[model samples]
Target: MGNFATLQPGGRPLVRFYLAFMLWFVGRAIQAAALVDPNVRKEFNDLPDDFSFSLGAAFNGPQMAIGKDSNGKVKYLGKNSNIVPQVKITIKSMEALFLLFTFRESTPVANSRERMTVEGNLSHACACVRILDIVQVYLLPKPIAKLAIKRYPKWSLKKHTINRLLINLRAIIGF
Candidate 1:
């Protein structure tokens, strides 16, 4: 009792334990929120379904030939020289939208295993739509572009992410 202020031998260990427990609890809570938020799920479901394109096809456009000149100077190429195929995805219902969103979020494109699963799901879902096509595209990173190109001969340089929901307001009703 006389030296209680300076005799807390186990106080530091207890404090550390409490902090660790709190952090773990908070992390788990955040993960749970990400998994169950209705708004997040709805946002994910609003992605398109009928659209499809390939990166390799984009590279095949004439733009690739318009590089720097022999003197190492950039050159401007004509507008018609580059032609990229446009993909238009159409969603018939809310259920289809949800399915697409789940597949995209769960399977990250960079991971081989995840990519395979996502591609499989996309293919399956595309079959349900009258005019949907699932096109395979290779991911190209800037730093490892050469290595990627060497590894996958047909890979393209363009990369894209599904960041927005392209919903046809006219087609969709209250949900």
Candidate 2:
């Protein structure tokens, strides 16, 4: 006699929710960073007025979008909004997203590994990645940030400490 067994796994809701929350927090941090960090602001200034970008998991999973307005201020546009973004960076799977967010794989490593897909203009995407790296350096502590960012920035006191504190506070307060 032979026994038959089959197994199929369902989606991970908790992972999806966690990724969504992280994306939201990162979006807010980016918005706040644009205001508090000169480097972030400078990057935003180089982009077009209508520029926008999104980071998310593929196949309509969790996501967050950020955009720069005519005034050159950046804002978190929420998840999967009706407004189409100029750049979209998508992780191939939940596992990949998990690894990236968990700091097991940095953005550059993930990109090199083919774990992410980028759409739209390449130059704009590179700028957005640089902005994100700056934000990560501000948001995370030195030890952990070194793992997440490709190259740790050579930041001064105001940028590494004062600006980091301001960015966190403003991001929490949503201004």
| For every candidate, C-alpha RMSD to the true structure in Å | 23.0, 1.7
Highest TM-score among the candidates is held by which one? 2
lDDT of 1 by residue, 79-142 (tens): 2334231221233322222223333322122223322212224543332121111111111233
lDDT of 2 by residue, 1-175 (tens): 2587776877998988888888888999999999888888999999999899999998778988999888887999999677899999889988899898888899999999999999999999999999989988988999999999888878788787789999899888889
After superposing candidate 1, which stretches have Cα over 4 Å from the reference? Answer: 1-11, 39-175
CA lDDT of every candidate = 0.25, 0.90
List residue ranges in candidate 2 displaced over 4 A: 1-8
Error of 2 at 153 (Å): 1.1
Cα-based lDDT at residue 158, candidate 1 = 25
How large an RMSD does model 2 have?
1.7
